[model samples]
Target: MKKTVFITGASSGFGKETVRLFHEKGWNVAATMRSPEKEGELAALDGVLVTRLDVTDEGSIAAAVKAAVGAFGGIDVLVNNAGYGALGALEAASDAEIRRQMEVNLFGLIAVTKAMLPHMRERRAGVIINVSSVGGRVTFPFTSLYHATKFAVEGLTESLQYELNPLGIRTKIIEPGGYRTEFAGRSMSAIGAGGIDAYRQPWDKMVEVLAGWPMSGNIREVADAIFEAATDGTEKLRYPVGQDAEQLLAGRVQMDDVAFKKMMVGQIGI
Candidate 1:
């Protein structure tokens, strides 16, 4: 029997790549996105079911999961990859943006996981791969709101590991560093406050650094890591992809809070 994997954010980036890779490897793929109608390629592939799923909406999540189960028997792996990056200064972010960040990245992820738990628990088998970022464990000059939501994901996933493991459900966090994806392009939103001139210099500097950095890791690396996490059958909770993620995560462990902040400030030229 072919294993079925239900992936969120499957319209593009890591999620889309994962869907292709999994389908190529003979897995039944529930490739879901907010606008499944707009997806042409994946929907044409064999054993791939492209459906609509908006993580922030419970009805959409439930309906998409139902469609996947109906099409592929049951979901063996669930990938929570439907999130956008809310960048820029925290002060510049409105209440709505902040809440929206948490809604899609944190709360939405939790809700999807919860919705899938009963099915996985009944079968006593499943893997949940969350596409968190290196930002989850580290911080930079701007992107405070985005970092907050990702940090919450890291903490939540860590804790859930303990509870889900005994029930045979695996939780894995994919922390990608600098990836040249829609995440840094169309999916990224930079929040700006009208009168916050004090933050402008730092934000510009940070943007310049990120834009010029040579750390463009392939999205396929992240897709490969997710595939491994789903099939590896290990207790490993976190998989850091890219050299940037590996180095920064190591630096976080080796350096103290002040030292880390100083390094970050200097890097961003703050």
Candidate 2:
């Protein structure tokens, strides 16, 4: 039987590309999104199940999983890609912003994993891929919340191995560096220390620095990485995509904390 892959945030970006790639590879795909109605082609694709799934909503999670399993028999892989970045000065973040960042990035990921655990555990097999970022391993100013959740995802996936590995359930984390996805357009919120004079200069510098960074339009590379993670069938845990991620992460691994901090500080220019 053909394997199945269920992906969250499949409306666009890496998730959408992954859905198409998997379908082209002749694998079943469950393309779950918050607004499936907004999507037109995924449902029409052969062996694709387009459904509603909001990671923050338990009911939606259950429903989406049920729909996928009902149609495909069982999900061989689960891709957790529904998340956003709340950038800006830490002080500028409101209560709602903080909660939302945590909910969609961290809590929602855990909830989805929990919902899939029983099914995978019973079968003694499955792959769980969490979409993280270079920020998860490294950090920059004005993005504390995004880093926090991604860092948590990194740690969470790593720790899951002790139990999950034994159960034949492999886990992988995708850390992409700079990507020209809706990440900056729709999937991000830039709420800098709102009008606070002390943060004005710093905010400008941060924005300028970020705007100069290289973000690739080749997002299919990331989807390819996700597909590899699902089919590689190895115990490998992390796949960092993109040249920027590869260089930064490699530099981080080679340098000590102080040296790494200095290098990152130089890059951010703040």
Candidate 3:
């Protein structure tokens, strides 16, 4: 029997690519998004069920899960990829913006996981792939809120892995860096209630750095990582995708705090 995977944020980026790859691999895919109508390409694919799912809304989450289970018999994999980047200095961020970031990136992931855990628990065999970022493990300027949310996800996934491993459920975190996707465009937001002048040099430099970076890693890398996390039974809890992610992880571990910060700031201007 073909395994079924339910993926959130399937309208674009890693989620959409994962849906395509998994469907090609003969898996039944539940490709979910905030607006299913916007996912016409994925919805038209064979064996792909595109459904409306807003992770922040409990009712929508429940409905999507039910629809997914109904369409594919059961969900063998759950991919949590519905999140956005909240970019700005922590002190400059509004309360509402901060809340929104946490809601979609951290609490929303927790909500979806809780909704799907029962199904996986009953089956005693399932994979929960949380789409985090290199930010989860480290921080950068103007992305403190975004980093906070991913950091929370890292902790959440790590703890969940320990709790679920005994129950035959697998939890994995994919921490990718500088992936060429709509994430840098559609999924990024600037906080504060003013123009870019407030942040001045740092903001412009950060934007320039991000814009100039090589868009080498594509969605396939992240999709492949997700596939491996779902299929591989290795004891490794975190899969750092892309060269940037690997280098950043290594640097943080090997370098002293001051040197690491200096290196990161110099490399990325963040």
Candidate 4:
């Protein structure tokens, strides 16, 4: 019997690539997105069942899970990957924008995980992979809202790992650095007329450097990390997935706060 994996935000980016990789490896794939109609290529794949799933919608999450179990017998792994970046100065962003960011990035993930827990617990075997970012561990200038959300995910996944490990299930968080994907284009948002004025001069320079930094890793690296976390039985809790991610993690571990800030300013020319 082929193992089944269910992935959210599977229409594009790391989610889409993971679906392809797992399908090629002979696993049954339940690839879901907000617009199933937009997943033409993924739907045409050999072992994939594409479905409509809006993570922020509880009903949509339930329906997608039901459809996935019906199609693949059961889901052995769940990848939570549907999220966007709300980038702006904290004061510049509206209350609604902050709430929206939390709703999609934090609450939405919780909703899907809550829906899937019963099924996984019953089976006594499962993997849960949350796609976080370096921002989860480190901060950036204009991405306060986005960083807050990722930080929440980091804590959520870490806490869940301890709780679930005793129940024969595993949870892992992937903190990837900048990757070449539609993430920069489609999933990023900026507030109105708040470009450089909203932040201090140094902060604006840091934002500029981040915005211009080349994406060093592709989707394959993240997908591969997800795959390894799902299949490997080791006790590794967090996997930082790219060169920038590794460096960021190292710096955070090695440097004090003041030193880290100075290093960041020097390196980014801020």
Candidate 5:
């Protein structure tokens, strides 16, 4: 039987690429996004069902899940790739921004996982791949809110590994470093940043360094990692992609907190 994969954020970037890769590999794909009507290419693909799935909305989540299951029979894999980074100073962030960040990144992922758990548990099989960032494990100058949500994703996936393993469902986290994605544009929740004077210098420095950073990593690397996580059948919990992610995460382990912060501050030219 052909396996089915339900993916969130399928309208663009990593999500869009993943949808194409899976369809090309002969798997049924539930290519979900907030505006499925706006998507044309993925909808035109063979064995692909383009549906609307807004992670922050529970009603939309349930409906999307129902639609996927109804079309594909049952989802063999669930990719929670529907989140954006809320970049900038913590103090500069409004209350709505804070809550919205959590709502979409952390809470929405949890809710979608909950909706899928029943079906997976019933069958005693499934793979859950969460698209967390390298920022989840390491901090930078102006990513306080993004770090908060991603950090939660790291812990939540780790904990789910323990609880879900015995039930036969596998959970994996894909931590990609800076890539040439919509991350700097549309996927950025707060593009207009910096109102606080205190954080201005460091924030500006971070922005400059981040801009200089290469967008050389093929976004397809992330999709390949996700596919491996779903099919590799390994007990691994975390897969960090790109040279940036590998280096920073490795440094995170080798150095102590103070040293790590100093390295980061130096790199960001703070």
Candidate 6:
């Protein structure tokens, strides 16, 4: 029997790519997105169910999980990839945006994972892959709120392993570096005039620095890493994708907070 993998934010980016990769490998895929009606490619594939799922909405999460389990027997892997970055000066972010950042990136992920745990526990086998960012382990300018959520994900996933492992459920976190996905484009949000203007100079500088950096258009590497995390059958808790992520994490391990700050200033020009 083919294993079933349920992914959030499958409308695009790593989630969409992962859906395709898993289907290519003959797995049943529950490609859940907020707007299933708008889905195109994955909706047309065999063994792929494009369903409505808004991670921040508990009802939708439950419904999506139910639909996936009903369609594919049971879920063997759950990939939490539905999240976005709310970028601006920390003080400039409105309460709503701050709450939203946490809601979707942190709480929403937990809700979905919680919804699936009972079934996985009963079966005594499953993999839960949370898509965090290199930001989760490190930090940068104007993304304090985004970093907060990701950092929370890192901590939550780490702690989850202690509980989930005893029940044969593997909890893994994927930290991706700069990838040319919607994350850097459409999915990214920049607070406008509502935000403090004093930070614009630094924000613009950061943007220019990023524009000079090499971008990885192929998100397949992240998808492959997610695949490995799910099927490798190891109890490993973290998988950092891309050289940028690996390098940053290495620097984090080797350098002190002061050194890391200096490195960030030089690299980000912030």
**Top candidate by lDDT:** 2
Per-candidate local distance difference test? 0.90, 0.93, 0.88, 0.88, 0.91, 0.91
lDDT of 1 by residue, 151-251 (tens): 99999999998898999998999999988788878788878443598977777788888888776757889999999999998989999999989999999
Backbone collision count in every prediction? Answer: 0, 0, 0, 0, 0, 0
Listed in order, each prediction's TM-score against the native is 0.97, 0.97, 0.95, 0.95, 0.97, 0.97
lDDT of 6 at 237: 87
TM-score of 4: 0.95
Alpha-carbon lDDT of model 5: 0.91
RMSD of 3: 1.6
Alpha-carbon runs more than 4 Å astray in model 2: none
Rank all candidate structures by their lDDT, best first, as comma-separated numbers: 2, 6, 5, 1, 3, 4
Model 6 misplacement above 4 A: 192-197
Expressed as tens digits, the lDDT of each residue in 129-221 for candidate 5 is 999999999988778899999999999999998999999999999999989988888888763345777777777777788789887558999
Off by over 4 Å in 1: none
Candidate 6, 153-204: lDDT as tens digits:
9999999999989999999999999999888676788863344577778888
List candidate 4 segments past 4 Å from native: 192-207
Candidate 5 local lDDT, residue 46: 83
Screening candidate 1 with a backbone cut-off below 3 angstroms (N, C-alpha, C), the clashing residue pairs are none
Tell me how candidate 4 scores on lDDT.
0.88
RMSD of 2: 1.0
